[model samples]
Target: MPAGGAAAGLVAGAATFVLMPFERVMPPLADGLPDRALWPSVILVAVLAATVFVAVWRTGEPAQGFVALLCAGAVGCAVIAALGDAAWLLFPDRMPDIVPLNAGPPPVRHALSRMEAQDAYVAAIVWGGLLVAVLAAVIRPVTRRRTAALRTLTFAFAALTSVAAAAGGKSEAVLAALAAIVCGMLTPATAARAGLPDRPASTAAGD
Candidate 1:
């Protein structure tokens, strides 16, 4: 919930400056200024859990609801990594202090590695989340691209966090990259019901 909310906040916050000059209006968030705990990331975790909790009570089928909630959690996790971790990895230089989301000006990217890292993050979310969507069956699924967009955001959030954690944000990029890649593995995986519908065995990874 907050992951989606934050991404929308990040993008929308940044855009506000465009529609109305920064001097005339409020400011936008930088890479990871607030910390989030991911700085709202912790809050986001709660929101994500709530989505599942709602499903547990709201859905018609227990199995369907549990399965959907699990997918929602994965989407939330991917968003966390994509936003928080990716921010610190890319920005490396921006470690603005915690301010309101729109407290300061929208941030500008300054990292030398921003382009490559940005591309990788985009690819992972686009391809990774889409694959999950293609395969996943949930009671209520988020738009395919929306989940991917959330997953990709972890990097931008991570970059800001990196500057905070590392002070200088150099080697932190390396760790962020590695972590993002690994987290990519969790990019909203799909789960089939426990039993194969036909019990037909073919070549599968665990098989």
Candidate 2:
């Protein structure tokens, strides 16, 4: 049996300090929902973040796994944002909006100005970390039943994002989502291995 429930403070503290810029890219609720709706989302995100922390701690080398997943998530976000930049160049009208879609065709989305691109880069880092913190938490590698259930959860999230991105006509986001999928599937195992001391006789295992 494994001791659990202790990582909540650690994860919450990390999310607070390290994820400060996350609010900038988040969807505004004022258009439809009341401002109070934000609290539920905030609470949900905290629970999800805690779930992810526990999952990673279980599936990988404890401290190292969590850090590795964080690093991998950051890199994945960077790559996705870079891909988004490329997509912006190719299709000036198709850049993503984190908001819900309206009923009609949207107005033209312009190419990123130099200053806007800088802000986008910062947002990317935050979104990447936040996304992995919650969404990728579903993965519990090494155990078949848990892995399948979690993989299903991860893929469901991936599907929702993919559909949303496609609906928004953000092909770059759709492509970037593939990186997220990879992160969910592999980061724990990769990080766990990196943390382990090599031995000739036995393979390092996870659950």
The worst-scoring run of ten residues by lDDT in candidate 2 lies at 1-10
lDDT of all the models against the reference? 0.38, 0.44
Each prediction's TM-score versus the true structure: 0.31, 0.31
Error of 2 at 100 (Å): 27
Q: lDDT score, residue 201, model 1?
A: 31
Model 1 misplaced regions, further than 4 Å: 1-39, 70-114, 127-131, 134-207
What digit string (tens of lDDT, one per residue) describes model 1 on residues 1-207?
222322333333232222321111223342325541243444445544555455456544555444444344334334533563356666556533333445435452323234324433333233323323322333233334433443554444344434534464434543454344333333333222233242223322332
lDDT value for candidate 1?
Answer: 0.38
Estimate, for each residue in 1-207, the C-alpha lDDT of model 2 and write its tens digit: 011222332343333323333223534332344554465457536654665566576665454345444544544455535543554567655344543345234442222232243355444534553454453453333333344444555456455555555465344454445445444544344322333444332343333
